[model samples]
Target: MSLCLKSITAVFLTFAGTFSAVSVAQAQGANVVTTNFNTVDEAINALGTSTYQTINTGYTETSKATFTFAVPSETLTLRYRTDNTGVALRDDTGALIARFNAGDRTASEAELMAFLRDRYAKDTEALKLKVANTPSDPVAGNPASLMSQMVSASFSNGTDVGPSPLTGGDRARGTASYNHLGISLQTGRYSGPGFSANVTSLPLSYAFALDDPRWAVKINAPLNFTTINGQDYVSGSVGVGLRMPVTENWSLTPELRVGAVRDGNSGITAVLANASLMSNYRLDLKNGYGLVFGNGLTYSKSLNSSGTSYGLSNTINKNGIELSGPFQHQLYGLPTNWQFSVVHTVVGGTPTYIDEWTDVSLSLGTIGSKNGVTWDSVRIGLTYTRANRGVEGLNINFGYEF
Candidate 1:
C-alpha cells in the first residue's frame, strides 16, 4: 500500500502545528517506502519485493524469525515475533534503525521517513569512521602478536641458573658424570588495547654430562595451553643446549628451540624458532653466601604465521643477578636455602610484545641429599613483572632437581 506525498505532508503539518525548517528541507526528498506499516510482515515483504536482495532467513528462537536483506550501500534486517511486536529495522552491524508497531498513529508517515533516512546516514558515517580507524598492520592487536608474546614469555622467564650444569657442575675428574632432571610450571596473562592473552605451560628438562665433567647436554620440552581473544589452543616446544665451561667459575651455553601453535579448528600452524647464547658466572662468597650472574642474547623468528596473519621477529638480551644463602635457623629440622633474583631485559620485543619487562623473584626451599646423591633441591617461588606496552603479570613457579 502506498501513501500519497500530499497526505504525508498534511499529516506532519497537523501534528507538528508548523512546518519546521528541517521538515521543509527534507520532506521533498523523503523516500515514501519508509512510511508506517500496519504490521511487521508488511515491512519485511515490502523490502523483499523491492531492490533489496534477500541474504538469509532464520529463527532465533521458537517465537522469533528474522529476515536479512542487503544492497551495495546498505543492509536492512527485520525480526518478526509470534506476537507481531518485534518489527524492527537494523543496519548490518545490528544497530537499530527503526521500530514499528501495528497501527501506530502518534507520528506521521513523513516523520517516520525522516527518522529512517537520518539513521541510515548516521550508520554510513559510522562505518566509514570505523574503517578509517582500524589498524592496517596486524601486529598492533592481532593473533600473531599474541603468539609472539607467548614465545617471548616462555623463553625469557621461568628459566634460571638454579643447580644447572652451567652453574655448579662437579669437576672431580674428566670422566666424572652427572644427571639433572627437573620440571617447571609457569603461567602469565597480558592485556593491551583491543586484545589479551593467557598462557600456562609445563616444561620438563633433562641434562647429562657428555662423558666429561665440564661438558653437558640439556634438553627442554614444554607443553603450553593458551587462550587469545577467547579461543583456546595447545602448543609446545623442544629446545637443546650444550654447556662448555670456560673456567672453574664461568660457563657458556648455546641453545636452539623450535615450536608450533595450531589453530585447532582450522588445522593451521604457526611455527617459531629461536637461538640463544647464555653465560653464567659463579662467585663463592665468604660465610656460606653464593652469587650467580647470568647474561643471555637471543634471536627469534616465525614461519607459517599466516595463521595469525602477521610476522613475528625479535632480538632480546637478558641480564640477571641472584644471591642465595643458607638461613640462620633450620626449618622442620632441615636447612633452608633462601634466594633472591632480579632480571632485566636490556632489549625490547616487537609491536604488541611484553618483552622489555623487569622480573623479581624470591623463594625459600630445602637442599639435602637424595638417596645416595649429595645434591638435591626443591623450591617454590613467586615472580612479578612489569613489561613494555603497559603489560603487567604475576606468576607462581615450582622447581625440583636431583
Candidate 2:
C-alpha cells in the first residue's frame, strides 16, 4: 500500500507540473492570440461582453475604417460591411480571419517572442538579399607542403617572374577555397629579374568564414626570416582581408597589409602597405567538376628607414596584375581542384621590398561531408616565381567548415 501510494503521488505531481507549464504557455499566447477568429460567430464569442467602437470612413465609398477596443486586444481593423439591401458579406477586399490550432501544444511567452523575432529577421534578410540580387544575367566565375615535425620552410627561388613583378604581399587574396577555418603555409619572392635586389617571404596564414559561407575573413602575420644581400633578419607584417560572394559563381576579395622590419635590436626600421583586389567567376562542369577564372590587381608602396640593413631604397612603388584559370575536378579522390595562373606587373619607383615578378601556381583540394555538416579539405600546391618564370614556391592549406 505504501509503494502504491508513493507512485500515485509521483504521477499527481508530474501532472501538476505539466498543467502549470500549460498555463504559462497560454499566458504567453495571450499576447499574440489577440482576436483570432475564423467566423463572425467566433469573433463575437471571443469578444464576450467587451464593448468596441467603429469609426466610419464614408461607408458608401471604397474606403473602410477600423474598430478598436482596449489594450491586450488585436489592433487590426478587419470589420466587414454590407449594402443597404442586407446583401451577404464578402471576404474579398477585407481581412479573412485565420484560426490557429496547435493541437494541445503551447509555448511560453519567451518562446513565442523568440519564434516571431527569428522568423521576422530571417524573412527580412531574405527579402533584402532578393532585392539586392543583380538584375544582370548569370555569369561564369593551394596546397601546403614543406613542414617537418617542427617549423620548416616552403620556398620559391624566384616567383611571379613576368613583365610586372608583384610584391611579396601584393594580391593577398586568392580564389574561393571556401573554408570556415583554415591554415596555410605560403612562400614567395617579391623582387623581379628586372631588378638586381631580392626580397622573399615565408608566411603562415589563418582563414575563417563569417556568419555566412558567402563571407570570410583572413589575418596573416608573416615572420619568415628575410635576407638582404646575404644579411638575414626576422621580418614582420600583418595583413587582413575579406571575401564576399557577389553571386553563385562570382566573388570579390580585398586585402590590406602593412608592416616593417624592426631594428635588429631597437624599434621599427621599414614599413610597407599593399592594397589588393581579386575577383573571380566560375562555370560548373557538373559531377564535381568546374572552371574558375579570375583577375588580381595590387598597389604596393614602401618606405625604407633602416637605411643600410637592406638595400631597400628610401621609397618603392609597384603595380601588379594577375590572370588565373582554375580547373575544378573530383580528382577521382581527395584532390578536389587544379589551377593555373599568370601575372604581370609594372614598376615605377624602385623600392627594395617591391618586385615585378610574374607568377604561376597550381593547387589541388576538396570539400567533403562527414556527418551532414561540410568539412573542407587539405590543399597543397606548387608555385614558381622567378626572374625567368620558373617554379619557385610551394604552399599547403587546411580548412574546416561548420
Candidate 3:
C-alpha cells in the first residue's frame, strides 16, 4: 500500500507541472494576438462570425449594436453607437477598455488603452477639484425649516402698502380718499448655521377706500427671487385685505394670502396659504401729524407634491409690533409729508419662523395735482432691517396715491 501511494503522488506532481506550463503558454499567446487592424470594424471582422456572439441591437438611444468575443483568458465587448465616428470597448467586468475612433485610428491597441487610462485619471482629478471649489447651497435649516422660512419671507405682512392695516402708519392724508398704488423693492441677506445667501423681492400694491371712508379694500402681489448653490428659485404671493374701523383711534384688517415657490433646476413646487389679523391705534398730534402703534398676527401653512413635510408645522403662528410717526415739513417753500416707522417681532417660545427681527423706514412726499391729473400723494421711502435667525434687508419704495 505504501508503494502504490508514492507512485500516485509522483504522477500527480507531473500532471500539475504540465498543466501550469500550458496555462502560461496560453496566456502569452493571447497577448500576442494581432491587434494591427486600422479600424474597430476591421478588428471585429477578424474575430470571425463563429467565434463572436451578437448581444443586442439598439441597446440604448446612443448605442445601436453590441457584440462580445472570448479569448483564451477573458471576454471583450464592443459597442457601436448611432454615429460612425467612434465605438466603445469594455472588459468582461464591464469596465471601460477603450474608445476606438474610426477617423483617427493611428494609435495601436496598447497605445489607445494607455491613453484612455491617462484620460480617465485626469478626468477624475478634475472632478474632485471642481467639487472642492464650488460653494454649497445656503440651506437655512432642515428641508422643513427652509420651506417655512420661504413662506414667511414671501407671504408675511408688510410686504406691500395697503389701505388701513396702518400697521406701520397711514399713507399721506387724503391718500385713502382716492386710489393708492405702490411698488417696493428689497434685497435681503439670510444667515443660518454654516451658510448665507442674498434674496431679492419686488411687490406691487393697490388699495381703495369705500364711500364711508371707514371701510377699505387692498390687494398685494409680490415676487421673491433667490439663488442657492448657483440654482435659481422664485416665490410669489397674492393677498387680499379688508379694513374695518373698530373705533375712532383703532382699526382692524383681516387678510388672506396664497403663495407658491418653484425651483428652476429641480422643477419642484411648494404651495402655501396665510391668514392674518392686523390692528392699529393712532395718537393724534398737532398740525396734521400723529404717532401710530400697531400689531399683526399671522398663521402660515405650506405643502409640496413630493410628500416631504417642508413646513415646521401645519400652522405656524407669527406676531409683531409696529410704530410710526408722520409729520409735516417745509421743502422749497412748500409743505411736504414725512414719516418714520419701526417694526419688531415678538413671538413666544422658540420662533418657528423669524425669531428676532426689527425694521426701520423713512419716507417723504407731497399731495397735489400734476400733469393735469389730481394726485393724492407721491412718495419715496427707504428702509433698513436687522434680524437674528431670519433675514435682514434694505428696501426702496415708491408710491402714487391718486
Error of 1 at 9 (Å): 31
Better of 1 and 3 by lDDT: 1
Q: Compared to the true structure, candidate 1 yields what TM-score?
A: 0.57
Question: For residues 327-394, could you state the per-residue lDDT of candidate 1 as single tens digits?
Answer: 77665465667778887764434432233567777766664333355345566777776665566656
Choose the strongest candidate by TM-score. Answer: 1
- Candidate 3 lands at a TM-score of 0.52
Sort order, lDDT high to low: 1, 3, 2
lDDT of 2: 0.32
Q: Which stretches of model 1 miss by more than 4 angstroms?
A: 1-176, 191-196, 265-267, 305-310, 328-334, 346-353, 368-375
CA displacement after TM-score superposition, residue 299 of candidate 3 (Å)? 0.7
Model 2 stretches with alpha carbons more than 4 Å out: 1-179, 186-202, 263-268, 303-335, 349-355, 367-374, 388-402
Superposed by TM-score, candidate 3 places the C-alpha of residue 366 at a distance from the truth, in angstroms, of 3.3
Alpha-carbon lDDT, every model = 0.51, 0.32, 0.45
Candidate 2 all-Cα RMSD: 27.6
**Clash count (model 3, backbone only):** 0
Among all candidates shown, the one with the greatest lDDT: 1
Which residue pairs clash in candidate 3?
none
Estimate TM-scores for all models. Answer: 0.57, 0.41, 0.52
Candidate 3 lDDT tens digits, 17-36: 21111110111212321223
